[model samples]
Target: PAPPGEGPSLERFTLAEDELRTVRLRVPEGTSGTELAALCDDLALHDWLLTTVVRMLDGLRLGAGAAQDAGTVVRTLRPAVDHLLHLWMPGARVGRELAALWDPLEERPGFTRQWQVLVQRIRDQLTLHAVPAVHREVDPAPGPPAVLPRE
Candidate 1:
């Protein structure tokens, strides 16, 4: 367990390897070609975003030397913060939400709830938009393809 007053560690934020394997197994065994393609695309996007967030947070924790850095430390934290902002600037509102989530751990002053918020937003966006977009794009047209007329 962490020292009293410290925030949860990045280990808490990680998805177990088994859980990821389970997600892989959930794809239907006999999906149609179009459905299979869409599923693959969605899985790829979901995996990429989740991995990116996890890596960023893990890097931050390592850089901060969370176990050894005295409470309220900030100097080693800037790179992690900058990386997150650069990657997610287009989703600034999401970033703000993340910061709000991480603000309560007074013992670990540099560790913020904002990281959790960022991870959640990225996951939510993947599920809500990226996956659906893949399906829409990969699914076949309802009818025959349109042919352009020669001039």
Candidate 2:
């Protein structure tokens, strides 16, 4: 049962800017704990990527102009790297029936692929900030510079 009025099996909310946004996904009735955990795992992945990663990316992008506030970028995103990134564990706990739910998401849109892109962008931003100013280069290599077009 969904402990006292959780709205619905797939309820969701963004509590605040810093905390992880929540998605109260309820497993189908009679689903095993393992099944529920699997469902939770999927929901968690979606929440972290949608809520945290996107927000961090937006912040990093907006703050990209203020490279001086690299510290702020660090302050804003370090916790996510330290705490949130490791939470992804896709089909681990899902029940057999629920396993199919992840398909369309991983198809053309590619949920994990999108997440990977966001993760790399965030890491790149962090790396850019972490480098000392004198050592930082406009374009790291001699070739045409690669860039992640803003989303």
Candidate 3:
């Protein structure tokens, strides 16, 4: 449970269309149930990766998009990261991997380089997990057609 008086934690970063495209490219398609289960496990790892990166970015006062005060950002994001890791990777190999990544971060003076490294790692993993190529329907019209659907 969180300490009294603290606000709700930050949600994990949302995947944008580009990010989803990257993920689709990495994870193979037509995966069986067992493989899907394994991918779920991998997703846990990926979540932790994102959480850690966000934590570091928060500490540096780098907003996801908008600007925010440094202390407030850290306060909100640190707990969020802790909660996310606890939920996703509790008593598992994901915990070990996070610890390994976090150890160096603890000793680092500034977060800029570390943040870049984390982002690159995530991108690489997303690429690796991308689904195999599949045909996509291309609508000839870029915008809505002149006709409208009947009620």
Give the better candidate number (2 or 3) by lDDT: 2
TM-score of each: 0.28, 0.57, 0.28
Clashing pairs in 2: 38-93, 38-94
The 10-residue segment of model 3 with minimum total lDDT is 21-30
Cα lDDT tens digits, model 1, 1-151, are 3345453232222337675522222222333456434433443444454456666545443332345232222333344455544443212232221222222222342222444566564444334434545676797879899999999
Q: What clash pairs does model 3 have?
A: 24-130, 24-131, 25-130, 26-127, 26-128, 26-129, 26-130, 27-129, 27-130, 27-131
For each candidate in the order shown, give its overall lDDT on alpha carbons: 0.40, 0.65, 0.41
Candidate order (lDDT): 2, 3, 1
lDDT of 3 by residue, 1-151 (tens): 2235432221222456555411221222332445434544555464455556665554543425555543444455555445543343322433321223322223442233544565554344333323221122443677877887899
Give a tens-digit lDDT track for model 2, residues 1-151: 5555332244343356777444445544555777666676676667555567787767654554555477787888888799878766666567666675565456745668877887887788788777865476554678886898998
* Predicted structure 2, TM vs. truth: 0.57
